[model samples]
Target: MSTSRFSSYQPFFFALVLAFGVFIGVMLGPIMGSKPTPTQARSTYTRMDSILAYIDNRYVDSINTDSLLDVMITNYLNDPATIDSFFKFLDPHSNYIHKEDLQGFNEDLEGNFDGIGIEFNILNDTILVVTALSGGPSEKLGIQSGDQIIRIDDTLVAGIGVTNQQVMSMLRGKKGTVVEVDIKRRGENELIPFRITRDVIPVHSVDVAYMIDDITGYIKVNKFSANTPYEFADAVIKLNSRGMKQLILDLRSNPGGYLQGAVSLADQFIPGKELIVYTEGRAVGRTEERSGKAGLFEQGKLIVLVNEGSASASEILAGALQDNHRATIVGRRSFGKGLVQEVYPLPDTSAVRLTIARYYTPSGKSIQRSYANGTDAYYDEYMQIVMNGDADSVNGRKA
Candidate 1:
C-alpha cells in the first residue's frame, strides 16, 4: 500500500519542479547574455542625468535642451558663487569662454583681427576717435585722431549714448566687408563720409620703442600675445641701431597674456641656459624654461617697470629678470599673478581656462599673492594701496 501511494504522487512532483526550472531560466536569460549600449558603456548615469530626466518628464513648460545646458554650464563655470558647496572652490582667473566669444578672445591673443581698426573713446555722448591703428583700414582711409564719429553705416551714433561694444560691432566685420562712417573734423565744418573696408589689422604688443636719451631706450609693452616676441625683437633691433646701450621696459598697467611671450621676453635678458621660469602642477609635472639662444639687448642695463596693474605674464617676466639678477625691477610692487592657466577646448568649440600650475622664478619663489580671503578681498587689497596713497611710495612699501 505505501509503494502504490508514492508512485501516484511522483508525476505531480516532477511537473512542479520542471515549472520552477523554466521560471528561473526565463528570468536569468536576459541578464546572462545582455550587452550595454554605447551610451551606457561610455558613462554611468549621474546626478546631472537624473536632474535632466526629471526636468524633461515633470517640467511645466517646454525647454530648449541646448540652451538649458549652456546656461547650466555658464552659471557654474563662470560664477563660482553660484556653484554648490562641493564645487565652490574656484579661482577668479579660471574662466569659461563661450563659443561665440572664443573667436574674439583668440584674436586678441593672436594679435590680429578683421576690423576697421581704430581706438575710440566715448566722450560727452559722442564717439571720439583716439587714433586709427597704423596700417589699418581706418588709418589708410585717412581717419585721423580727434575726429568725432557722427554716424556708423546708416545708424546715427553721435549723441545717442552709443556704447563701446556697439561701436566695435559696427566697425568689425568679415574681411572685404565695407563699413561707412561720417566723421566731423576739428577744422572742417562738413561731415566727412568715408567707406572703410575691413581687413586684418595687426594688434601690436610693443606700443612704442624709442630712445629716451642718447644711450637709453624705452619700450612700452601693452600685453603679451603670440606676436609679442617678434614685435619685441624688432623693437630691440630698431633701438640697437639707434645707439641704445640701456633699456627701460615699461610694463606699468599692463595686464599680461601668453606665458610663451613672457618666457621669450625673459630669454632676451637672461644669458646662456639659465633658468628663467619653472612650472609645477598635478597634471603637468615640473617643467623648466631656460635661455637657449643668443638674445638681443642681453648686454644692456635692463630695467623692468611694474605697478599694481602689472600681472600674469608681466609678473613672470619681472620675476624671471629679478631672480636671474639680470634686470632691476623698478616702480611699485607687481600685481601678484603667478598661476599658469591652460586653455582646454571642448567639443562645442568653447574653452575652459583652468589654472593648471603655479609658476616660480629661478629662485623657486612664487609671485602669486594669497587669495584665501576670496577674489573680492584679493582685488580690494590691491585697490586699497591707491586709496591709502601707498601706491605713491617707492617699491610699494608703506613708510
Candidate 2:
C-alpha cells in the first residue's frame, strides 16, 4: 500500500508525464553569485530552517539536522541518487534539477536545444547511447541507442562518475565545432570512435493537430514551449471552422512550459473569475490566475490525454480545466508539480528560478508535491516506481 508520503507525490506530477521531452519546472538562465533580495533571502532561509528542523526533530532516529540537511543538499546536487530515493517515499513528482541539468531538460521540453545532438544515459557508470539525433552526425556515423560511449577523446567515461552534466559539457560545444566520441555497442565489443561536428537542432513542440476525423481534431502537444499557446490557439481556430466537435488535446508526454502561456490557453476555456490556480509564498502575496475569455473548452467535449509525464504548466492547465469540469482528463493522473518558481535577476545577467510559492488548485489542493526531505528522496522514489511498475498509482486521490 502507498503511504501518505507516497500519496503526497501526486500534486507535483499533475504537470509531467516523464517524457524525455520534458524538462524542469523552472526555466533558469545564467546567474552570477549575488546576495539574495531581502524577501528572497527570507524565503531561502525559511526553507533551510524548515529542512533543518525537520531533520533535527522528526527523524525517527537521532541525527544532526544541520549537517544532514547540508549533506542532503550536497547529495541532491552532487548525486542524482539523493533525489531518486527521496521521491520514492514522499512526493515522487518533485524534481531536483540543478542549473547544469537544464540542458537535458530544455532539450526534452523543447524537443531540441543547442547541443551536439546525442541521446545518452548512464548504465553501470558507462555512458550508453539511448539514441542519437536522426539524420545527425551520430546516426550518420552508425551510433545506436544500445551503443556505449566508452570514451570522449582519450578521456574514459567509465569507472569515474561521469554525470549527464559532464557528458553534455563534453559533447555540446559551440556550433561548427567538433567532438570526438568513442562507443562500444552491444554487438561490438571493441570501442569505435567517431568525430562529430556540432550543429543547431530544430525542435518541434507542436505535434500535428489536424482533423483526425470530421468531428475530432487530434493535436499532440509534446511540450509547452514559448510558441505553444500561439500555435495551439491558431490550430483551435482553424479546427473550429472545420466543424470539430470533439477535440483530443493530447498532453501525454508534455512536461510543461511558461505559466502565462498555460493561463492564456486555459483562459480560452474558462469564461471569467474562475480560479485556475493560486500561489502563496513568503514574499509573494496570494497571486491568483484565472481563465479570461479565450479558451476553446466551452464548445466541445474536450478530452485531455494525460499520464505520469504531464507536468508544471501542463498540470496547471489540466487542473484548471478538470477543476472546472471543462474537460474530461483521461489516461492516468499527472506529475503533481505545484511549486511555483520565481526567476529573479542575478548579477551575471542570468536568473535564479527559486521555489517561491506552492500552487493550489481551485479546490485547495496543494499541487506541489511535498518536498518533505528536500529533492533527494523525491527522485529516488520515482526510480523505485519504475522498478516496481507502480508509476500508474503515483497519484492517489485524496479525500
Candidate 3:
C-alpha cells in the first residue's frame, strides 16, 4: 500500500516539474538564443515605415500609393515648417519638378521637342503665334508670325482666357501625330484651317543674328541651352563674314539655363586662361571655371546687353565679361541671381533642382540678392523696382 501511494505522488511531482520547465523556456525565449518571429521583428521598423504600414493595412479606404507618395513629397518640400533645421533659409529656386513636367523641362534645356513647332504668346485673351518655327510643319503649312489661333481641334480656344499651357497641350503631341488648328490671320475675314503633323523641332537659343551697322553685329540670345554654343558659333561665323568688327550680345529679358552653356559663351569672349566664374558651397566646395581653347569672338569689341530680366546663366555670362573687362555691360542692372542649382533625379522619374552653391565672378562678387525676408518680399522688391522705373534705367541714367 505504501509503494502504490508513492508511485501516484511521483507521477504528480514529475508532471509539475515539466510544466515549470515549459514556463521558464517561454519567459526566457527572447532574452536567450531564440530568434524573433516575423511579427516581433516588424516592431523594430522606423516611425515612417510604421505609419506607412498602418495606412496600408489598417486604413479605412484603399489608395494609390504612387500618387500618395508624390503628393506627400510635394507638400513636404513646399511646407516651410517641414524644412530641415540645418538649412538656415529657404531657397525659392530649389524646387521639386513633377514627373509629368519633367519631360518638358528636360526638353527646354535639351534644345528639342516633338511638336508642330510654333512660338506663341497669349495677349488680350488670344493665342497669337509669334512665329512658326523654321523648317517646322506649321511653317511649311504657311502658318506665319502674328497669326491668331482661334480653334484647336473642335475646341474654340480664342478669347477664353486660355493659358499658354493649354495651347501647348493642344498643339504638342508625339512625332507623326497630327494636330488641327484654325487661324485668324491679320487681314482675313475667314478662318484658315490647317492639319500639321508634329515632329522633332529644334529649339534655337540664338533668336536672331544680323549686322546692325557696317561694323556692329547684334545677336539676341533667348536662353543658354545645350545647343547655345553651337548656335552662337554659327552666328559669329555669319556675322564675321558680314564685316562685323564689334558684337552686341543681347541678354535682355533672358532667363538663364545650363551653367556649362554660360561658361562656353564666356570662353568665346574672354581669351587666355582667365577665371570666368567660380562656385562655392558647404558640401560642393570651391569649383573654378576658366576660359579654355581659342574663341571665335575673342578679338572683337564685345558689348553685353542685360536688364532686370537677365538672371542665372545670363548673369554669369554678363558678370564674367564685366569682371574681366572683356565687354561693356549695357542696359539696366542684371537680375541678381548667382545661385547654382544641381538637378537630382528621384526614383519616380521626377526631379529636384536644389540650390547647391553660390556663384561669384572672377572679382569674387556674389550677385545674388538677399532673400532673408522670404520669397514674396524678395519678388516684391523686384516688382517695386519695375514700378519705380528703376528697371528701365541704365548706369544711373534713364533709357
Candidate 4:
C-alpha cells in the first residue's frame, strides 16, 4: 500500500501496530521500489493475527484508538516503556520521538533553533566553544571560539557530567530572553561574564569557513540540515573572493541529516551531468539524483574529511565524491548509514521515523554496513573497528 493510503488508517489499530513493526524490524540500504498491485487475500489466522483481526473487525468507531493503544499496551507489554525498549532492536536510527521532544527534533532538522548561538563540545569535561556563530548573540558579546562555558546562570556545569542536551536546555529559549554564562578564557584569571539576549539562532550546516594560510580554504560542516547547500555555497563564494585555490570540506563528527542537502553539496564539487546517488526498493523504483549546472567550487582542488562519526548524508556526499573522483577523502571510515527515513507525525503529536529506502552511491554500492546481528552489534562493529586498529584501513567498498 502507498504510505499516504496506509497512514490514512491512523484512526485505526492496525496502522499503529504496523508502524511499530516498521520502527523495529526494517533494515537500511534498500529502497522500496514501485511494484504492481497484489491481490488482497485473508490467508493466515494465527494468535497475534487473530488479535489484530479482532481489533480491525470488532473495535467500535466512537472508541479512541490512541487510548486503545495505551490500554492494549498496558495489558500486553505491561507499559509503553517496554514497547519503547523493544522497538530499538529494529534499527540503530529508527525510533519514536515523544511529543515533548518532537519540537526540538524538528527544530534541529529545520536548520534554525533559538539559542545564544554557539557550537560547543564537552572536551576534558568542560563545555568548550567550538565556534561562536557569526552574527549570533554570543558573538555579539565578544565570546570567542576558544572560550569555555563553566557555568550557566548560577549552576557550575563544568566537570559535573553535564550533557549536551542539558546545556542546550539552559541556553536555548524564546527570542528576547536573556541568558547569563560564565566563560573561561586563556590567560584570564577570573571567569568572564556575559549576558546574552537569546534570539533565533541559524543552526548552520557549514559551521565555519576560513582561508587557511594563503590559498587553502577550510569549511567545517556540522550537519546536513535544510539550508546546508545554500549556506555552503555562500561560504564558498566568500572564500573564492579571498583567493582560495584549494578547499578542505570537513565532515568529521557530523552525524548526517537531509539527503537532498548531501546531493546539493556533492553537486557543488562534481562538474557536468554526473550521477551522485541512487535509490531502489521493492515499492519505490530506481530514483537517481544527478549533478545539473556547473557547481560553485567545480574548478577548485577539493578534499573531503570524514571519520567514524560521519554518517548517512555525510557518507552519501563522500561516496559521490569518491565515485566521481572529484575529491580526496581523508580520515577514517564513515559511519555506515545507507538507509533513508521518512518522519510521520502521529495524531497525538508524537512522531515515528520509518526506514523507507536504501540508498546507493554513484558506483551502485550500498552505504550501509551490516546490521544482521542486531542494533547493538551493528553499533559495536564500529567499536570493533577501532579496537582492531582498522580505522585507517580503507576497505575500498565504494559505498
Which candidate gets the maximum TM-score versus the true structure?
4
The CA lDDT of each predicted structure is: 0.74, 0.64, 0.75, 0.74
| Cα distance off (Å), candidate 2, residue 45 | 26
Instruction: Give one digit per residue, the lDDT tens place, for model 3 in 1-399.
Output: 124433645765676456445433433344423443446436654343344444544568976544565576578655534443213334646766666656777776774778998766665588767567667788889987667789999999988887656777878889999888899986799999998899988777888999989999999987898989999999999999999999999998677889999999999889999999999887788999999889998988999898887888999999999999999999887788888888899877877778878889999999898776766677666656544533321111000
Candidate 1, residue 378: the lDDT equals 71
Off by over 4 Å in 1: 1-88, 116-168, 174-200, 377-399
Please count the clashing residue pairs in each candidate, in the order shown.
0, 47, 0, 16
C-alpha RMSD between model 4 and the true structure: 12.6
Q: Model 1, range 93-145, lDDT digits (tens) per residue?
A: 67666565567677667747788887666656887675676678888889876
Q: lDDT score, residue 72, model 3?
A: 67
Q: List the candidates' TM-scores in order.
A: 0.62, 0.61, 0.64, 0.65
Candidate 1, poorest ten consecutive residues by summed lDDT: 390-399
**Model 2 lDDT, full chain set:** 0.64
TM-score of 1: 0.62
Better model by TM-score: candidate 3 vs candidate 4: 4
Point out where model 3 deviates above 4 Å: 1-89, 116-167, 174-200, 379-399
